[model samples]
Target: MLRNFVILFPAFVSLFWALLFMMRWKRNSRSQNIWAVALLLLSNSMSIAALYWHDYEDYSLIYKLDVLETISTLSFIPVVFLYFERLTGVKKKGQIFRKILLFIPPVLMGGSTVLFYLIVGEERAAEFFKYIVEHDGALSPGFYEYRYVYMCINVYTYSAFLVVQAVLVFIYAGRNILMYRKQLDDFFSNLEGKSMDHHRATLKGLMLFLILVIAIAGSGNLLYVDFGFMVLVFLFLLGGVIFYLCYHVYFISYSADNFIMELKLSDEEALENGYGIMGEDDFGNADTGNMLRAKLLPQLTQVIEEDKVYLQNDLRLDDLARLLHTNRTYISRFIKEEFQCNFSEFINRKRIEYAQELFRESPEMTQEQIAEMSGFTHASSFSRVFKQCAGMTFREFQKGH
Candidate 1:
């Protein structure tokens, strides 16, 4: 049974990691994608190491496999930290220092591999079996002395690193949960009459589940015997369960439904208050109900007036959502339903409008500067959008209009 477990565990871990990898691939590009791919590759390599251990007893082969596993294991720490930073929207300029810290573990593993090769020598390294069966069929072992020490170092180092990484993630998750809770409180505070207990409940529940998953996965690593692989599997299963539960809860929960319903409440308040703008039939409506715009038009107009949203490079849906005190879904839906466009189009329209104004008023500002100031992270995207929206290239617009 033990032998079977030894052979099967790595494969199971690999399969779970592969599923996570595929999930990240389908999402938009972000730093989390980097962490997901790194972990997926590390798990795959660990799977190969386990297979090699089951199939080969050659000391040299074992040494090489250990080297590969050590390298992958060591990388888990920094990648995890990077994932946390990206997910939290925290950017530190001196991040290269963190990258340097990540290099330490791999370098140590590589050094140990070289040291083992020198001490064991080629002939003995090739044939030395690391384990032997006792006369009574009980366990006995024989391994290269220095290599065993190296292995211990590798394991202990990775375990310590894992603990540290897990703690960091836990702390970050806790902070985020608190912030989200506060935001929910503020949002609900303004509501009149009936309580927003249901919406608050669902949102808080989802956030709590997410925090619990991270906590379980992190603490499980410390408690479990096999680097928490089994715990990780359970975590994955739990996460999937929670995800489906939240999906149902979100759509069916009266609070969330009420929130959506609020979009339609008080048509006069929606239209006359500048919170909602009526679009013509040209904007393609599947239903008979007229699409309304955000009631916070003055606020949005102020954002446009200040030109802050478009001026910042690396603008994202979440950023805009944060600024608007709304969720990404609402912002995305508003852009789609009211503007008859997507986020990129909505952003580009604002940018192009600003660029046109700049071109006319400030002939001194270069097109490149205009593009940068217009909230484009890249000149290419700005140029493409400008041409599409203005019916002319930036230079042409500047020169002709």
Candidate 2:
């Protein structure tokens, strides 16, 4: 009973996640959804291989199932890379190449597994399969010594592939997430409805979780112990990890979809408004990035100075980019290339300058009131930045006044 549960528990979980992903795909129908669905197929293949390897042990069919277990034991990398792809704005034309690259390892592994079985004769393979299963792969050497060595070597080699792939995905995905944070002065502003700090922490947590998965999966193979016990431990960990991934995927999709929709609306508005955001001037001269900044600065300065956009509690690069009829990348570049600072610093400096103006106009206005009018969401945060930028606390400034 325990042995069957060990195999079926993860199989059921895999099936559950597959169905959930299918439901998600029905609604979203994205490129990532296809790979996510493919990852689940590999999950099912891995689970079935375990069931046959242990329960239907000592059979020729069990050996074949074990070979095909190469369907991708470490399948999380593709799923994660796809998730980050949309977030980082990978173009659709290039995704076909990325999808093919991600599948190369699994395809090679599966093809080799089939080739290995075909090269061995029926009778000799049967003997080999029964012996390995009966011994639980704790075999020494016999006439089939080379075959045993081959199988052991294959497992370790595949584990190495999984480890390296996970690390690479984490590195690439981690850098993009960081870039997104820095480019948007309003970190949470571009996240649709979610909190900025929460989502950034979530991205970091996901990368760490992938590392944890590598450690757990790698440990099981390294520890030569009872096959059944190892399967039990592995499935338990798999269940927990799968649940974590599904929960996060849900929220990421929810937020990203909203973000895309909002951007679409802004695009339509920009087109209708007839703003020359693409560096075109009235004289019809094409403006360079620097020239574009010069052309754009007057309109942007007027918007902030007269309209008081910085006074809004929530200001996003997306909102500014849309109004200017440009893009987030351009806006971020405008700040760094033109102003010598990142978006966050640039926006905060504006808010601080506005706050100082407020202080001068209304001596009786509380710092809390000033913060509310200066685009800060919290009085505590406003006070902290006020001191940092002005070189004195609110109390000190107030006392001088």
Candidate 3:
């Protein structure tokens, strides 16, 4: 019973998270749904571990379940990549075809497992399973030849697949995450809940988890290590990491779907309201929009400077554009051209100046207090930006003041 519980713990944890993710399905986001499915498949995949840990007398039954086990294990790989793909907006055209291609490896693995079973036959398969369990894979040249060849092929192929999968997923996910940050900086002023920092942390955790998995698998296959207690420890750690990932995913404040939807609405409204965010290409003459920029620049400066719109902690380009009766692209371009920064940087620069003013007025103020007063939603952000803008740490700036 202890062995059974130990092997099943991660599966149970995954199922629990799948249900939790389902509870939020009313939010109707593709990423959430994909994550729930990934967890569900992960639960199914955990069942294979039980075959190793439990004292199963029915070798035939174990052979019969091998195909399902193989499918479950390999299927989670692509579903997980799909989840991150959607979360980070790396989705492209031909999505259905792409998904089908992603699923090919799992299908091939399951098919190969079935073919191997048919070739070995039920009697030999049971004997093979019995031998491995009874002897801990210590087979003589007589019995070992078949097992050794097959196990080597299986382990090496699976290990190679895992390595390639990890490389592709990490590269694409890391690149997309960096792009996500740039997107946030382009559109948002105060990026408290808008950042992908949580996702980046999760990616790091996944890297460690993958390393553990590779170590365990390679050690088990090649080194003939005792797996009973090791498997239990691994399951425990896997359960903990899954719990951390699920908890953070469930409570994540940022939603890419909502962000994109809001941006679409802003664009549609801008087009309908005669502030179409026209570019130089839209105008016949290169300098045609200079008069409009000349007229709007002062109003933009007045709102940011005199009216102190930058003090609003959740300020955005759309909000500023609405206040100035302009389009987002126009405001974005104006800030870039006139102030030599994006909207986010433009707002943060003013906020930092305000923070400096506060420090001079009240040198005893805390970082958190200054952050809140100067429109930064977090002190950590304030501290980082303070160093970037002031060329010194907050403490150094405060001491000088």
Clashes of each: 3, 0, 0
Give residue 26's lDDT in candidate 3 (0 to 100).
83
TM-score for all models, in order of appearance? 0.41, 0.72, 0.88
lDDT for each residue of candidate 3 in 1-401, tens digit (9 for 90 to 100)? 77678678888888998998888798746877888998888787676656655667898887677677667767776887787777767556776775787687678767777787778788887777666666665643455556655664456666666566666666666776777767777788877876366777767766765666567556645322246677678878888888777766666567677678879998888778866656545333546677777788789879978999999998888888888877777777777878898888888889999999988898888999999999988889999888888889898987776
Among residues 3 or more apart in sequence or in different chains, the pairs in candidate 1 whose N, CA or C atoms overlap within 3 Å are 275-294, 275-295, 310-375
lDDT agreement with native, every candidate: 0.52, 0.63, 0.75
For candidate 2, write residues 227-274 as lDDT tens digits: 557657776676666556555555554334455666677667766775
Cα-lDDT of candidate 1: 0.52
By lDDT, who's the top model here?
3
83, model 1: CA deviation in Å? 1.5
Candidate 1 on 1-401: residue-level lDDT in tens? 55546444544554565465466465523543554555465565546545442444465566566567556655654565555444333435666776676667667765776576567676654544243211211112445455446445544555555455545545554454344333332233112222234334434543554454345334522221333356456435544544442333223322322433443453434344453333344234544333224354555667756746756655555456556654554556666666787665666687788788887888888877887777765577678778889898888876786
Clashing pairs in 3: none
Per-model root-mean-square deviation over C-alphas: 20.1, 5.3, 2.9
